[model samples]
Target: MTEHPSLNKKQKQLEPFIRDTFNQEMSSNEGIKIADDENSLKAGDRGPTLIEDFFAREKLAHFDRERIPERVVHARGYGAHGEFELYKSLSEVTMADFLQDPAKKTPLFVRFSQVIGSRGCNETVRDVRGFSIKFYTDEGNFDLVAINIPVFFIQDAIKFPDLIHSVKSEPDNEYPQGQTAHDTFWDFMGSNPETTHMALWIMSDRAIPKSFRTMEGFGVHTFRFVNKEGISHFVKFHVKPLLGVHTLIWDEAQKLGEDADFHRRDLWTNIEMGNYPEYEFAVQIIREDQEFIFDFDILDPTKLWPEEIVPLQKIGKITLNRNVDNAFSETEQSALHPGNIVRGIDFSNDPLLQGRLFSYSDTQKARVGVNYQQIPINRPVCPVFNNQRDGASRYVIDRGKVSYHNNILADNTPSEVPVKDGGFVTYPSTVQGMKERKTAPLFKDHYSQARMFWNSMSAVEREHIIGAFGFELGSCLSSAVRQQMVNRLARVSRELAEPVAKKVGVTVPEVEESTVTRSTPAVSLMNTIFVADTLKIGVFLADGFPGHEVESILKQWKDAKLHPVIVSNNLGEVSGTGGVKLKVEQSFLTGSPLKYDGVYLVGGTGADDYFHNQARKFIGVVYTHFKPIGARKECISLLEDMDINGKPGVVIEEDAQFGRKFTEVMAKQRFWERPSYLYYV
Candidate 1:
């Protein structure tokens, strides 16, 4: 199939605005070309700088105010251009144009971020990830403001500020910039037990995703989807990665945090390399009449519908194939709002969802100005009609004399259309309840689902969760806070709490344990899809390496669609024994074992003592992390010395077809059955 010029229709529209500054003379904000930019006007060469240098003054003034106020949450973000193709028509459940036609494709922009971190924070920090996407449908723009995790720390949006405040670094000290492993966070968790479920999620491998393309996304709140017949169903949005849901183990995540922007860099590089990320868009739907059937409240923000109970209906596929031209102009300026819905999608009575409708609108006004939606990235493909006038950064120009409704001059042009003509219409949901600041009684039972989450984990995921809790609670100086967390964990599961209690040096008090022992296996990461395509493999080689072996490995790697990175003692070409030379992509000092999914140790004779020792050091790290290791010829000596040769994920072969076997092991991701293990370097 011939590929389109741009990733989507929306990107094609943005092409004209992309500046061709390379071949053109430099110009000011206006069209006037600049003669010189080296110096400001002055009385003489050494005289005081003059104030009359308009070009210089304009440049400096713009630079001074280049930054906009970063988001209070989800500040550190990266975006991509994509198109969503409908795989199946969801017309039975929704009248949304994008969801109605299988042949139609909707252009979209997705911005992934680390919530609760500043703009400069590392992407690998253990935290909830933001996965907001803006879909440009002909009817209007639909923003699916979602998160990687299905649940949240709080049930109500009113407590959102408190949740962010407590999870952030302490006010007086402002230390520990990117993590929630602190006293204040635990204290808040202890006081508000509603946070127990989400705390477990953040402590699990889900918090540290392997890549943005491998992570799952969820619309945290229950919404309403109305069919053409005006029949409504409570809905939850889900995105399953075609590459499979995966994560960085704690050890790799910690090391990557030091490098920072690891995940951001991965997303950018993959798109640029034409390895576009794809995910299937699905939804869990519950009829309005069956809302009361669930044991938990449907409107609760911190709960999820088990996939087994409410099966997901796959509707479409979203493929991100283009990287942004400018980060700030395309990514930072983009605004997403849950309220930006089409006629088919409507808000539910979910309290968190209700408050977010107001909060997001207000935040955009304060952060990006009232005209934020008019910004190119946020603008809808359809015509925007409104009676409102200008504000800061307003790009639209209304030429009509009258800008208000009920006007005779413009004859009330841009009049609203009826529902039959694809006009907006709210689901006439009848409301009869007291206006009070309270939630339903069912929202109080936070432990049952938390326990279900614990019971659902596979053995490996369970151990990681326990280690996460131990590390997080152990960092807290307050024993009381640690004990409080242990007690809360006991309510979820005794197996989860006991080990954490011992690690944190706390006595786990016995809380009423949840009787819910049933597990939802679908939620576990152990059941995710495993493949070798696009996996980054680090290749270790030195001079005098066998050319045939290296050449053979590269061929299999290319066949498996794996990224082979050459790691040696230094950069530049290294000669093979068969007169075959290879370029070193990264040295040991620059390329750490944590960066690649697997490694290949090809034997080399002409290496320094330091290089030999570094080879062994790299093997130990990879072995400890349970990553797949492929050893050929002389490199087998390095693995043999470690006594981990022929391990579960270690493939050592002196015979032919070594690369084929190694490629198979890389697809499994990690070998958890290795003899004895200790997490962290």
Candidate 2:
């Protein structure tokens, strides 16, 4: 057990209130049983619901009223409840209870979202993912409303509305739902020029994450950490997955969107199987006096503090160990804001963050209700007692007269707490600036970092980014939009812009130099982490010849902590060598290999030619992506006909060398070493 910073006077008082409120909301309300909330009430004959169903009505009403207004952006989302366990204290940097004490486990709720989609939109679309976490600590609820992408499209908050409006469904037809492949988006990027870095990110594999568990999360804004002595330091937050960052190919992502529910199913199934996702909370700290050391403005959300300059400090681990009991009640109703912070954590003058501080709570009130914080999922676990009363769905029972301050009634009950004992005191940074709005000169340079990102990508990652750009531009009916985007790309790198232009059948734009010349190499996907643990491999087999072989391979896989599912043509006992049998987890006709991290073929007597053919097709796909492939002697013979021998990640044995070879090959994961430049459809 590690010691975390203890709750001060206020948090200790408020803790019971939040806990009690959570209990009250979870309890039976008006004879409505929420225990069995997963299912809906049906008639005895299973024909229709009974009219006298008050419980059904309550559930439906709750569902219907559940959708407060979807966020103008980042509307489609999924959330989970978890705990953040600190690995070490950061008392030197800040006095935040959650950060200073390694022993305290703070319960947190996290929401992962698609920036351009609606509440019911697809998950795998090529868009920035919202990775927001709200820590319900004893001090207060500290919300880090962040994104998977490390940077923003624009530097200034004033341009935020414009950026969103351009990428959203067009005002005229409202067509191109949940996509940026259109005129306005390209036109904005072309004109702004500053969006080049983020545009590269949007084009990269980072936009199409394989899962929320596999993607990296970033605060995307410079903040401040204040200690007991009122000293401030610039800071950035990062959430690196222990499993490492991973993404699906553009082609796979599109197929995934053919069923928009793909991510939801993947998450739910994995959690049900006890594959809990974990992420390490890290921070990039910079002393306040050293903010000027970087070429780019530290406060610019569009730019990143290169990791080489400030390496990430791993402070804690956050595990999504439990799934939401009800999606609508918890995931949907939950609200997150960057403004929520504890005593030690404080905000910087980042314009984007300032805008978000105003936007989140305001939008929540409009979407949920006037008293949105009173919503069970949104409410803090800490106690909230004040003169604030009488709003829509306001459940608090203020005991006694005088709800206002400084009145004789109720003897000034719920009086203000002093700051010395424990009260939120905003870091008193001096603020004096002209009222007129203008973007700082430091925010202007954007193409250099964009070029750095493009230059740093691996060959495969670069190709996907180019392909993504082409695919998106090709979807645009407007020739002008495509030309404008091509022109914008030329400023970043002509090498990048030319291929995309040719593929879209447009002439490459002329090289136009931008004012910005500084590049930060740290902002590239090529530099992200990768590991094989938890990688799912679909093993397609029938009544197999070698049951022990399958079990042996499975044992090794278990040792490696890799997930191997024995799939078959049908769900039943799949007999192996010497009549040993393994239960089929899924059938090929029912599930696709695209869901798996890899695939293994095990031949047996029960497998018909049709089954072989089906397995062949899926195996071909797994091989095309250079994913791990495994087979025994008979299985090797089967793959040889398809010319799969000698391919990278292909494991085969002439006799019984299968288990050892397959395990070694699978451990390496995808073969980026594969020389095949050919793109397999």
Candidate 3:
């Protein structure tokens, strides 16, 4: 692993806790070896069982209580230990110690998760992805709780539980585990207009990211960056992945059921292979005075500030270089809360965020024990001093006569410090209003920004959105719910609703065109970064292939940092015409097109009809999915007979410059403009 000079201390702390129970004799909790663990001491092997069997009771007792309550939402997740290094100091915006110095690297642990599912849910689902990070700063633990999308389903925190309940599986059935494309979710959206923008986002390609490493993260709620002078700016945080944003098409997403661990496995395998995931830390800063001037409410969690209006200012980067040692202890027990803010940071009146500050801590307390922070994974790197003592799972012992604060016995030790002494100080703000149940006027107009999002999408993205809407609505048994959603969508754009209405058998209501025709270019997936690095390419070949021709292309792929897996009709060595043999790592039955970013068709010489038939299926799926395909001269015959020659992303290596040209094409990631792109829907 590439170790950052500043992150070594975190590794040192966790090293002592690493357990190596390998090759040890299996025993009960008390270290007693059981003579027979199998058969569970049941009925004494077909005779009457005895209550005196203490070993069996102990094993069964532990197994029955092994599970704790999974998170109410975002239960399915994967995590990695990493460090964040600030390249640009934000002293002008915040006095937050971690953001003030460019020379220091703050160790952090990040958990990427899918919302609205249990811990065992599939990874590829049409739902929001939670992107939470805990920075073990010397000031304490600072958690930035975020999501993949910039907005949310509700404006107020009071409605948060209702929103989650509506999207989750029906309480009576509990059938669907990992998806939001169901009756209750659409019904909830149709009834709640505040969810319009986030509903559109969930149906977009952002929901089904190709990998956790390729998706963007957003803080979702507007926060404050307080400077030493006590001046604060309204800020929205963003995490831009270096690998670029990408997603699987709906068909490929469905195929992920066979390997639901694709997203999680992709992260672990790449990290183990030394392909560390990196993301740029960016933010949109609005002066406190400018917050009230935005067309959309800055504090509304359901709305996003247009990036074109407030450009993203790049500040730093985070590199995830280490995978978690244990899922339950490190990834599960660690609690991330929005309330875990450091000094230079503070909260806004964003209702959703305000509620999350309370909910996260409460949930962690219930999920883990009362002293959850005392857990090894959740403990801070810095020395901690507090008056709090003894609770369940307490790891600290308070010495001598004082466990309470403001006591003469301990000389008022562990007392709070003044704002000047590195203690947390909230920014002073004037407040003069009676508490009431009401939303701001700006939060009421939701359709305008939703319309702007619709206009931002490219033609291909628009088609995908329409297909997503149709599929989701079609799954509903209630025609009224489908029609309601179609009508709600019409408010965003008639063009968007028309196609979806036709497929869902709902009437297209006559709605006026949206006046907000302008689009924010930054939100579109088409505008993301794309490179050839770390993309997986499947190379199909058989015996008696052209070794030199294949080797030349393989060299190009290695130079481009693309991983190529050799595929054939069966395993074992395959002889080439040049007397060189290549090891086959995968076969036709073992390989699936969804597992690769692209495919290379090469050297089909001496292949039987069955072999050729398998090659045809490979090419067809790769082509239909719009991935890049390259075929050498011998393999060109295989692609030619299928009549897929000269397609948008297909490259035939006949000319001398074929290898170079094909490498350049694969760098584009996918061929979205191919004529077959229209055929997928």
* Local distance difference test, each candidate: 0.88, 0.79, 0.86
Extract clashing residue pairs from model 3. none
Deviation in Å, model 3, residue 15 alpha carbon: 1.8
Number of backbone collisions per candidate, in order? 0, 16, 0
Prediction 2 TM-score vs. true? 0.89
Report the CA-based lDDT of candidate 2 relative to the real structure: 0.79
lDDT of 1 by residue, 194-301 (tens): 999998899999999989999999998999999999999999999989999999888888888668879888999999888999999999999999989989999998
Q: Candidate 2 at 538: error in angstroms?
A: 1.2
What lDDT, from 0 to 1, does candidate 1 have?
0.88
Per TM-score, the best of the predicted structures is: 1
Q: Candidate 2 residues 1-681, lDDT tens each?
A: 322355433233334444235545443457444666555567665668777666667767877854456778888888877789999889888989788889888888888889886777787888999899989888778999989989998877778889989999889998678878788888888778879889999998888888888878999998899998889999999999877777887767877766787777777777777888899999999997897887788888888877877888999999886677677767777888899989989999988888888988888888777887876777777788887788888867777777788876667767777777678899998889889788888888877677767766777777888888888888878888888888888888777888999888788756775444444555555555666677788988877457776787788777777888888888887888876878888888777867878888776887898789888988877776678887766777668888978777887655456555666676566687764444422
TM-scores, all models, native as reference: 0.98, 0.89, 0.95
lDDT of 1 at 202: 92
CA error at residue 437 for candidate 1, angstroms:
2.3
Residue pairs clashing, model 1: none
Q: What ranking of all candidate models by TM-score puts the best one first? A: 1, 3, 2
Model 3 whole-model lDDT (C-alpha atoms)? 0.86
